[model samples]
Target: MPPYKEGRERMKRKHSVWMMILVALMAVSLIGCGTTQSNLENKDTAKPAGKITIGFSVSTLNNPFFVTLKDGADKAAKAAGADLVVVDAGDNTAKQISDIEDLIQKKVSVLLINPTDSAAVVSAVESANKANIPVITVDRASNGGKVVSHIASDNVKGGSMAADYILKTLGDKGNIVELQGIAGTSAARDRGQGFHNVVDGKAGVKVVASQPADFDRAKGLKVMENILQGNKNIQAVFAHNDEMALGALSAIQAAGKNNILVVGFDATDDAVKAVKDGKMAATVAQKPDLIGKTALETALKVAKGEKVAASIPVELQLITK
Candidate 1:
């Protein structure tokens, strides 16, 4: 063989080997780039791992009952290492709807609503539903929405208990004035119905006057005063909530009537104190804190794809002195 031909063969072999090495390096670089791009796409589409957020749209923080409820939710969220974003509606139905919309925009994993007005909050609930957000109603329920769960006491039973207390105390012979809560609310409607169920049929128990005080303490006093002007022979008063009952008590005390029994609902701190002091007759106990805690636990279960009951009822009892 010729020396020149051998040298040419060696150079060709070296060139081929270098070309192969370059091609392998380029393939490695392309594979690395593809992996990074795929990760970026996944990150953009899905949430970060182990992040769960819950939104709570409360009716009003001003009311002590609702304030306690919020505190319970906050406590549970902290215990579970979850995030809770709360918005207060101040008892305004429109504000509550707007608040819920904002929560949906935030893309919360779950939504908890304590509706100010059961009928008016339907649209807000439907909006959450359309967003594919699960909704759990606390304390108060929406009249026309698909709710994942509703957590509240049996208002009708509470009302019936109130009426029974009155009848038993007065021997079913008394002229009673009812100071009602806000009209159209489930609590108001159910409580009033329960009261009527027991009182309407009694021969001697008469509902001489029943008026709505909007669940305001001051309004309760004013309305009772007006009722007193016309019905001076009233023997008992039933207020839908503690606020109104306390108000009516004030009016009754001012009117120098000490024998009239006053029954109320929602045994709040104030109402309980009143009952202890014998200032008020009786009030139904609805544990708002338990309701809040149960609601949070249910939301966690639901967010994790667990099934929960459609209605969760907390225990209720009558508080009397």
Candidate 2:
């Protein structure tokens, strides 16, 4: 072979080796990118932190008892570093259901309900159950659905206490009138039953007139007015709650019906004052504020997936002048 041909062949071989080295480097770079990308894809993704919010559906704020209850719940929620949303139903069952639905939509951590009517609020409770939100009853209870817990006083016993006091003060024989609460609430039913159990027919002590005042002071006054017209010989009046009791007291005062001892439930501020002023015979003291506070605390525990008791009871007492 010629010397020029041999030198050209050696240069050609050198160029091929350099090209192979470049291709290998390119392949390694591509592999490095793929491995980096795979590592990123497999890594756990971080998510935004979420805040816990609670929703409360109150029966009516017009009444002092429920108002105090709401205040307690509000204070509790604020201390826990959680948001509290409260809705008022104005003692309207339909509105309460709507309020619960809205709360569900808001994705509240817990749903609290002060039902206007026990039976009517079932579907609302069921709706919360469907959403997997825990429900805790305040002041009043629901007739149906799965509730996380119920916190209330023994209404029946409270009712019995009222009746016993009335009868004892009346000397166990007098014409008594019973002022009922909202018709379908557990408080109404239990309280009425308790009164009846004690004074149904004991020593001729009788309930001369029994009517529902819907737990409103204005309605209570009107109902008492109507009852006063027909039952001239009535000696005492028993109202289911302080609102109704206070109403009846107004009517009794307005009618100039003297010596007719008036008693009420729920020792609301007004009722207690009435008793102190020597107008009302008594009012049942249901610590609504404590009930409200306990409810919020239980809800927080539930939010933490902690187990809680099925029922919680608050203290009940009778206040009299």
Candidate 3:
């Protein structure tokens, strides 16, 4: 009797051990499954599964023109069901170059750049080219690089329009001042060329003084103040951008000067209001918003390996009071 009871006790103990082992194994398996599910959920929620991202490197956000451009790009990107990442270079060429590198590393589908300086941005553009990322330049162009496309207004024509307005207002016989944009930019170079083409050989319309205002309002004001100290008989002023034109107008007003015709480009909202108020004689309107939208559209096409124009020109208009 004692031997049979002992055998029964041994069997019960073995059964208990087997049940405990099975429970432990199941617990581990459940935990592993939960971990996997959590990881998948986290990954799915963090980002869209197949959304394409576009990188936009802006020269400066301080300018209203660039802000408008960014707005247009953002709207277009949203409408196209694409993601956008924007970085402002703050008018620093080196920063812009670094920003482009960062975007390249992110593996963006496309890059939209508004260069701070044309020649200086070539290296950045080339980096994108080497990485096989399509780049579409907006507003300003790189002097050297294989860009898919460039979107901007006909700045040369705009400058000539300003010159014509100045000559018509001043009778083509008055001394003038020119406030230029940032050096090494296509906008400034082309605009300056067009202005000079009209005024360089014109009779009695001398360029008494010309200076680089760096497309900045503060710099324009300071430069105009200095120019006024030397040139007292200036009859008209042409600025490559509206910011500089407004700054020049401020200087003219502060110096108690009046009736000096001032012309500007970009036709920013403030500049348009100034023209309507008679503070500025006229401004060439380059639809910055439209240019930005066109840039994004072209970038999307390029990312899809589609053909796009090498140069896309936006229309320009002259606004006068």
- What lDDT is reached at residue 151 by model 1? 93
- Across 97-199, the per-residue lDDT of candidate 1 in tens digits comes to 9999999999999999999999999999999999999999998888987999999999999999999999999998989998888887889999999999999
Question: What TM-score, computed on C-alpha atoms, does each candidate reach?
Answer: 0.85, 0.84, 0.91
Better of 1 and 3 by TM-score: 3
Q: In model 3, how large is the Cα lDDT of residue 59?
A: 98
Candidate 2 — worst ten consecutive residues by lDDT sum?
42-51
Off by over 4 Å in 2: 1-50
User: Over the stretch 165-198, how does candidate 2's per-residue lDDT look in tens digits?
Assistant: 9888988999999999999999999999999999
Model 2 C-alpha RMSD to native:
7.6
Look at candidate 3 and tell me the lDDT of residue 233: 95
Error of 1 at 163 (Å): 0.6
lDDT (Cα atoms) of all candidates against the true structure: 0.92, 0.91, 0.94
Task: Estimate the lDDT of model 3.
Answer: 0.94
Candidate 3 C-alpha lDDT tens digits along 57-80: 999999999999999999999999
Q: Candidate 2 versus the native: TM-score?
A: 0.84
The full ranking of all candidates by lDDT, starting with the best, is: 3, 1, 2
Model 1 quality (TM-score): 0.85
Model 1 local distance difference test score = 0.92
Q: Candidate 1: deviation at residue 272, Å?
A: 0.6
Q: Please report, as a residue range, the 10-residue window in candidate 3 with the lowest summed lDDT.
A: 43-52
Give the best candidate by lDDT: 3
